[model samples]
Target chain A: MSDQMTEGYITEDGRKIGGTLMEMKNITLRFGGVKAITDISFDIKEGEIRAIIGPNGAGKSSMLNVISGFYVPQEGEVWYKGAKRPQMKPYQVAQQGIARTFQNIALFEGMSVLDNVMTGRLNHMKTNMFQQAIWKGKAEKEEVENREVVEKIIDFLEIQSIRKTPVGRLPYGLKKRVELARALAVEPHLLLLDEPMAGMNVEEKEDMSRFILDVNDEFGTTIALIEHDMGVVMDLSDRVVVMDYGKKIGDGTPDEVRNNQDVIDAYLGVSHD
Target chain B: MFYREAGDFKTTYADDNQTFPIKFDRYRYYAVLFFAFLIVPFVINDYWVNAVFMPFLIYSIAAIGLNILVGYCGQVSLGTGGFMAVGAYAVYKLMTAFPEVSIFIHILLAGGVTSLVGVAFGLPSLRIKGFYLAVATLAAQFFLVWLFNKVPWFYNYSASGQISAPERTVFGIAVTGPNTAAWATYLFCLIFVTICALIARNLTRGTTGRKWMAIRDMDIAAEIIGVDPLKSKLSAFAVSSFFIGVSGALFFSVYLGAVEVGEVFGINKSFLVLFMIIIGGLGSIFGSFAGAAFLVLLPVLLKNVLVGMLGWPTDLAAHLEFMIVGALIIIFLIAEPHGLAQLWRVAKEKLRLWPFPH
Candidate 1:
């Protein structure tokens, strides 16, 4: 792990992964008495797709929540960009350029898709309430500037047609796309996606996989995603961290994780003693 | 046909994002403003000004304020009447203390004072939400009313236990007090309503509004997306309170000329504003106006029809008015929960696609 951290590896497709962007060290998270994640340590390299894979109740979502600063691990440190991250609210973490999507689609249902995406730019918009109320020079200029960025995201996601449509009326696939657009609107350094393709059909899955790859390739964003689909995980991720029953079972390239016997047993329903 | 946006292409994001994106809507808005400013003042007598326009305009401000919290921000506040009392009392103190200063400055200061009080009450919303938050604000309502009633300073220790608007003017024209002309007061309130509506519309459309709506739709997600819940919620309270306070000041100083805090700014007042937003359409500026108009006009219309036309007793007409409002509230909630604004929106949408059904 130290060797890999010092000298980043190149993927088979020859995309150079940078040094560690985020590192979790000895993370132990518990909800009262039940341990959600126990002693999980993994590093996400910059400009690489990192996957956290586990079966149901394997604490995959919990790990994502911890990364997004929604859940503070009972023990262990979170290091970002060579500095130890402090205890902060989720919004503060987002201000530090960490953005995530929910397992359940968390789009603002009452708002238009454009508005929902614009919310991701909240950290970037700096005009005070007074300026916003008057909306003449500073507020209007800032809004238009932000709107340009949001419109780009909407265009990139091919959601321009539904820009003015309320998110509650959008289909499942479109909602997921809009969520991705929102996350992208943040211009985040590290993007965390919790089950980006959970309930998606085959075509939707393919589209989402393409979008994920495109986001990584275009933005050079460090991607940390929790996914159930083995095929998608193997194809998309440069490194995979396999968890089972609140423990890290394996951490390596997708090829190495697939070959690991513990990972195989965990997925194949090996009973715990 | 005229409501359609077919050829109305926006060249820039600014053009696209203007309050009224459609050219027809923009022109219509301008026409309304022109009529309100120029034409209405000349035609409106004291009866129309007092019975219809003043209450509608003042209540519209209150409804807009409440809608910011309840509709746009998704914070259910039952303390609007309390906040309004803060404004009324604050203005009474200001008006009496600084008699030479402009009434406009006093009203704005009153709103500022109410916003501070609102923020203080809004503190609990960070921890609680939904019905519980509503109840907490309800406490603010009762406590505020009680404080004003108990404190002598609020009513200036008048023997009558009421605060009356001292004569005040704008540019040597009396806009307040018993001697003020009907047109002067109406025009004064119309200016405020227009300004408040514009400010409310701008705030709700800009980044602040987005932050608020984000907090409203989903707090946790909003927070994760970088919207500070504390700032957003408190700002909603502050802004909402400001508008409510302004209306209260206007209601006292400009509209009614004298007010007793308990009788006027009571729990009923809070519910009235809430009903306006709910029946108007939660989260819409136009809904705020629509709801205020519906409520303010309903009683007057009822009185004229039942008492004047049918020759029914006034007391019976009043009771029937309450029954009708109650039934309408239930019907609106059940049938069109978004209220009259949504109905208007659907009509416009249909109109845009008229003469050819898909």
Candidate 2:
């Protein structure tokens, strides 16, 4: 991993301070007798790509779900921004500017690609049924505004050709891109991509990496992704958190984590002397 | 070339988002409207209009209402006939009690009444969805019918357990009652159907429709997308109920004249309307008409030709119609699950590029 020589996708306006955008303190998520994530504490900083990497059942996805408010931990406090995140409705959580793409592509299968992205803006939009019924004044204006942003997102993701195509008809890579575009459309302060490069070909993964980097660079959007690909988690991320069996085994820069004996042991699932 | 959107330019957002974006579609709609209103009157006699066309128009409204819930929102409902009864009974009672209010207002008021009741039954929707909610709606169906049957006030305490529409008219044109003309009732029904369908088109093309679609596609994802499932699902129920209720009132007041709650608003009626949606097309507005037309006209036409003209046994003819309709439903579902509306679309597409599909 490159260090200090124009490394780390940071904004031009500012420099890094060890200030946290998200702090998961003493996170413990359980299902019945099974503990999914056990007493895991992690912090994500502003304007950085952080990767949570673990084995198949290592609770990497569970951790992401907890952060996105899809799952509530049995015991933990999620500090988003400066305030404690109260137990919120999922939509409420989304409106508070945290958006996530699902592990499995969750685009509205029947809806067109453009509409799938527009679904992300459902929270930002402010219009009622009556205005929509008439469509001459505010509804029309809001629609135009929302559509412009969504179209821009479609263009940004290089999905202009599939704007009118149903998400069901698209290839896996394109669907993942559409899902990313949808999450981006929310204008989220915190963007979570769960295995964005999970099923992509090399070129598709490269395209996705570029988009992820672009999202952080251009929009100043904070990205925390769960990726299984070691190279991606190393190259794209500023810092990486390594986990094994629901516990944080290692947390630091890619080089630090890569060279850590404990991290190697966790990856190999062996005890380090 | 005639049916294509290739050269149809839309400069405004409204124009672009129109129900019929192509000029060909717009003209086709206008032509259909003209035939139903002006031309159909000249050729079809009273027996045809009263016995067949009136029922067709009335059921078409209900089908459109159901389309909003089932087709647009992807919520399955089986309580349509029951809600329609609510409209019918409510209108009947209103007509009897006041005896002075405009029939126009009563029919609409019945719709409002049905909306409230529909919302009540739509409660289980929040907790359970899909087939579960469809089953839940059956409770509303049974309960509504029970309320009308067991509670005497709905039927004006009639011993026969039925509500009848007394003399009702709009501008001296008899719309309902024993002496009411079929032409007047059909006109009244046609007007309501046109307005409701237009409003529904506007809704489905805009934000509300998207909200519903979002909920339908994936409720959990819809929530993350900032759609309030509670409000959107309920509004869908309320709005859909209002339309179903109005159609019900028309069925009772304008068409049936007198209707027994259990007999008229039973599960059979619900399935009948659902068959319309399935056969015609699920979500298409035009599918509503096609469904109503097919379901309504098929039996009548068959009865006249096969049963009456050919001197076939009445029961045999009824069985044959059942087999044909059922076979068609199966074939349509397997071949093109989209239904008659899709067929209409394909035909138009073919017409647009006749002999040059490639």
Which run of 10 residues does model 1 chain B get worst, by summed lDDT? Answer: B1-10
Query: Model 2 compared with the native: what TM-score?
Result: 0.94
Model 1 docking category? high
What TM-score would every model get versus the actual structure? 0.98, 0.94
Report the poorest 10 consecutive residues by lDDT, candidate 2 chain B. Answer: B10-19
The global C-alpha lDDT for each of the candidates, from Candidate 1 onward, is 0.92, 0.85
DockQ for the candidates, in order: 0.90, 0.60
Residue-level lDDT of model 2, residues B142-200, one tens digit each, is 98888888888777777787777788778987878888665676778889989888878
Instruction: Name the regions of candidate 2 deviating beyond 4 angstroms.
Output: A1-19, A271-273, B42-44, B351-353
Fnat for each predicted structure, in order:
0.91, 0.62
Off by over 4 Å in 1: A1-4, A271-273
